[model samples]
Target chain A: MSAGDDVAVVGVGIHVFGRHDGVTGLEMGAIAARRALADAGITWQDVDFAAGGSDAAGNADTSVSILGLTGVPFINVKNGCATGGSALTTAHAMLVSGAADLALVVGFDKHPRGAFNPLPEDWGIGSWYGETGLMLTTQFFALKIRRYMEEHGITESTLAKVAAKAFANGARNENAWRRTPLSEQEILSSRMVNHPLTQYMFCSPGEGAVALVLARSRRIRELARVPVYLRSVAFRTRRFGSFEVFSPSIPIESAPSATTEAAAAAFEEAGIGPGDVDVAQIQDTESGAEVMHLAETGLCEHGEQESLIQSGGTELHGRLPINTDGGCLACGEPIGASGLRQVHEVVLQMRGDAGERQVAKHCRVGFTQVYGAPGVSACTVLTV
Target chain B: MTKTRQFRLIDPELIGGTEQVPRLIGSVCAGCGTVTFPRQRSCPRCTSEDVQPRELAIRGELWSWTIQCFAPKAPPYLPGGVEEFEPYGVGYVELPGEVRVEARLTESDPERLRIGMSMELTLIPVPGASDTLTFAFRPVEEDE
Candidate 1:
């Protein structure tokens, strides 16, 4: 492959994540796609390949009825929280293979209030497991973080700090759902959803959409003035003995989480070290997720979060800003859209277009990670 | 005197011992010796078909824990409504030399729960349905 065989994100768009009263998920996706196309200074007919997905929303390809059916090869992806990542991976491969000059990948989702009520049969668990009140993603996160805290000397204050920082950033992001910055005390004292995690600390399942227009390296300069190079994209699933969501039991032996593996692989492929990342967007399903992922993604040491977070190292102006768009914590997690949202935020930050919430550092390299149910993770590295 | 009728477990395949000393039903792989709860037909580690049903240990130490303060949505969660729900303890108890099992704990107060504390397998009424029983792990008393 030539040096110009790589792919880059030329444009991006988003349908403000949170409650959308009358709009369907498909309509949001079509809207985002059109916005991304406009940002790229191109029309839908110019796209040669497309891919997208949503968890509870309709098939991604069905958005064509709204976006105008140009007969694009729109592949549908459904990898839980990694839905957007999987779509990007597919498009990246297609572009690198010389099959497509331009690609449009979108992800959108609309979930009902409260936690996701997934079926036991759908996840290979017996009904008894769910009936016993052990089927909650919140409980799993709480349990994992509880153990991690005990082992790593992480405090409840640190957990609250993560959520507070998310809101602080969200307040600056016009499209974010929870725009009001909350104090760490407020976050800590909020109604406890799961022990050690309060209402303010966990992100609610909500609705939104995001789209990205990618192009072959050679076409990036022509399509956009400041294209964010898609350095690498990696996805991985759980290995045996790893703790994950929806488990009745875990093996005695332990292994690295999917996020750990995917992050390592993405960094390796991008030839970028964790220390070099000026900005990042890791999954923050809850405060604990962000804390553990900070270490798992090799961004920091396992126990360093206590000091890193407490000292404001994760703030937008800090040494390494994380989730500058407020992440799932403030924007709310629209499963399919959440992953793509991370990438979109990185692209905006790299292009100096993140507005009020942009990183203070000169961000040359940015990283994004999305982890989800059934132990799946997707990581990406982007450069200006 | 009238005798009390015995309550049935949530699922027969999950537990397999007398009421006084109930044990979780698990499958041990003949190929890799990996033990899985609720008895799988194949080994998760080696994908071996030579898996056999085995009654897991009844005692273990709490590995990790949390309290579920909100009631889960119904359909998948066959339990009480939001108004009738009470916060409950949830945790993973690691059986010695065996797998760590996730279960509801009898204790909901965080002050009373700690990792590495001794826990014993027991049965509790499935919330909202006292007629049906489900497995749980309760802190072991000092005298017992």
Candidate 2:
């Protein structure tokens, strides 16, 4: 995509992420969508199209149904945890293609009651096993952590520091699910969910919704609103069956193709490089994944994440503040909405409206990433 | 009077196809050298409808593994309750034909697992349950 057809994010909104005892997924999406429309100084009638994402099949329909209530045509997208990023990408494409002048993208999910298992009945490789039982998401990431540690000489204590930092940041986010700060001692003392990974090291699965309003750059300028342009949005899946052969212990670095491909495409579109990113929000289902993403996102070199964390480079006052809105570790993962939440934070930081949790100085550009299971990844670079 | 336990609802496809043997289904693209496990009508690599069904090799090596000690937050699946097992190990098994499948490992002990260990696929009954079976990996000794 070229800058000529670039779309700009004019407004963003999100419901506080946490357990909501009474609200359904539809209500959450509607609430965020309304807030986004208001923030953009427009009404629901102004939306030319709508896009949504949800992990729960039921929730996807609910989101689409809610958007229809606004009298706008909508499409539902599902890409596992990357659903939100995928939704935004779809909205951007529609605007750039002239399918719509104004579009809304929303994502939301309600935590499931029990273990999260990939439905094997769905036509996919996961369904082949007649009844081998459900596999927990933690197990897949735990294996990656174990492998990373063995290969990179990383220790559990190092990973705990990331959790601790996220918890501290979470305490500053009024919308975060886990508002309490965790000390290194607390994070270290937490019960183990997977060896080397404790309870606090993982993001909580909660109910949440995020919405964004996007328009063609020309329209944004005409509307007299600060334009947060979508410089580049790229989605790439790993070569099937390559995950196992490629350093499972340090897969993030080994699968440089996915990250680099997305980054190159995005940067090329943005007319910038890694050095130009003032802030970033990377996908980290677990603390270990955050460390790995630091390297994969090019914020630091491989095997240098631990030192980067030790140097406090990712802190709010650090050179390049990351996940300043607490991240999944603190804000909780709403699956479908998590990716959008990352972008929302970046937009807020860029606009200097992040409240108490705001990063020092102004941020002009930021990057967000999200990964889907069975090996799919998406990255988007945004600039104000 | 007869007493019966409530059975969980499961997809019939998972109850084993008519063949009575669990088969890992995937799609191989004729236009490009790409294989998609669990079958796709259109090839992901080449985006061509010229795809055919291919069965994945059941046996593979253990690429990596981990034990789950926490409860998951989704549906149709239950974590080990207070009365059941608290934790279990799962691993990504790399099949001979280059498919990476996730499954429960028969080896519950973490210390016993090695990254490159040889493993074979097997269909076994769910622990403490009957009539329902799931796929898992069984360590293969050199002699076997």
Candidate 3:
């Protein structure tokens, strides 16, 4: 009667994650949305409600324009990197409230080149802070990962291993950007973008889109051959003391990161624990993030990453494979679209449709999460 | 002695953002005792308007650090020009009992720096940018 009652993801689609030199963000989003509708075996006019968020650079409400001007309620929710998750959550509410039988969730972005240099003033952080040149998103990932490595016994090798695995998994994904299989040593020796995090160890900002078509259980049973149920979905903004993006300072004693909090909430909502998940796709803006998030999601203990990573426990054949489709590590993040991309991978895995890179174990349940600035995170649990 | 005027790129608050012997300006909430760098109009914690400007400790230990190898974009960050730009070290220095400040690290050699080592603030003059002054933290030598 709660989260997973009758809402099901009948279809999902994603644009290849890479540079779309001449294409606009809206164009890329439209392509993915159309693909999703086609997969859902439904026309655009069949959608009763649409939810999504787009980057300011490309009009936020481009979902309607891209999906064709359906007079349905097209609500665009913007919550940083959690935008896609927010879209799914909003659409699910419509089904639960008996407001809509079918819904569409779309997310897309075309990031500016180079590292993200957010105007400090825009986030109320002031220009002097930006002038310090310390607010670069690269540095944020580097600093946090550096601190995490020190606190936890995570070795530089462990970081390299995560990237190596991600790139290897990404190599099997036709939609991934950096599909070249990277060895651990090569990742370790890549150009140092920031200490502890080499260039290969980080996900670059890129253009892409992801969309999901959802329907009530009744409609899904009739239309979809195998409906992937939305087990749980949750989004959380950063609470006080979190060392999130654009923060001037964090409290000495603080709550866990946004991803950690959201993961806990998603698990609780679904009444499922980490052990129940057969596959997972977590945030990996940097290799360290994947490591930290794996532990934060209660998938493993804080200091267990060193041994777990060495045992190849997170590989595709492992008991609980993580980042099966390379995750953000191989497919550079497109912010709004990244969360749904995680969902798409989980859906494909659940449906036993993933080729080559499919997990060795049957994926009955899966998890996906995304985290971003000024401080926000969204997580969802899915199952067949 | 040559005379030169010093300015904080935008705010005057950063110049004295810390208190103690070095004195960095900060804001304190009368209701909740919350202290923040670059003085704000009110307390973020208690939503109290009784927030007043105060000074924060200038000394702290190194919490974490990173090196910015790429040149920041032109507008907000005046890192001279790309050719003139050199990679610099930055870190979050934790002023015990106060706030952890994000500032440029004076030390670039990772070998010489330790996470818990004591750090002291030192103002760095930015060239090309007229009369601009920025801050950095250097590892405090035992002999000093």
Please name the candidate that would achieve the greatest DockQ relative to the true structure.
1
- Predicted model with the maximum TM-score: 1
Query: Taking the true A–B contacts (Cα pairs closer than 8 Å), what share appears in each candidate?
Result: 0.92, 0.35, 0.61
DockQ for candidate 1, please give it. 0.84
List model 3 lDDT by residue over B1-144, tens digit each: 112343543356666633223466778889988787768898766689998888777778999888887788855576573446778888888988877888888788767777888998877655335466667788897667
Candidate 3 lDDT at A110 equals 90
Q: Could you tell which candidate, 2 or 3, scores higher by lDDT? A: 3
Q: What residue runs in model 1 are displaced by over 4 Å at the alpha carbon?
A: B1-4, B79-83
Instruction: Please give the DockQ score of every candidate, comma-separated.
Output: 0.84, 0.23, 0.62
List TM-scores for all candidates, in order. Answer: 0.98, 0.80, 0.95
iRMSD (1 decimal) for each model: 0.8, 5.5, 1.6
Q: What TM-score results for chain B in every one of the models?
A: 0.92, 0.73, 0.83
lDDT values for all models: 0.92, 0.73, 0.82
What tens digits encode model 2's per-residue C-alpha lDDT throughout A127-221?
32323334356766787777777777677778888888788888988888888888888998988787768888888777898999998857787
**lDDT tens digits by residue: candidate 3, A75-147:** 8788777889888889988887889988889899999877776688778876777676766877887788889
Steric clash pairs (candidate 2): A114-B74, A131-B134, A132-B134, A132-B135, A147-A249
Q: Please list the Cα RMSD from the true structure of every candidate, rounded to 1 decimal place.
A: 1.9, 6.1, 2.4
Supply the global lDDT for candidate 1: 0.92
Candidate 3: which docking quality band? Answer: medium
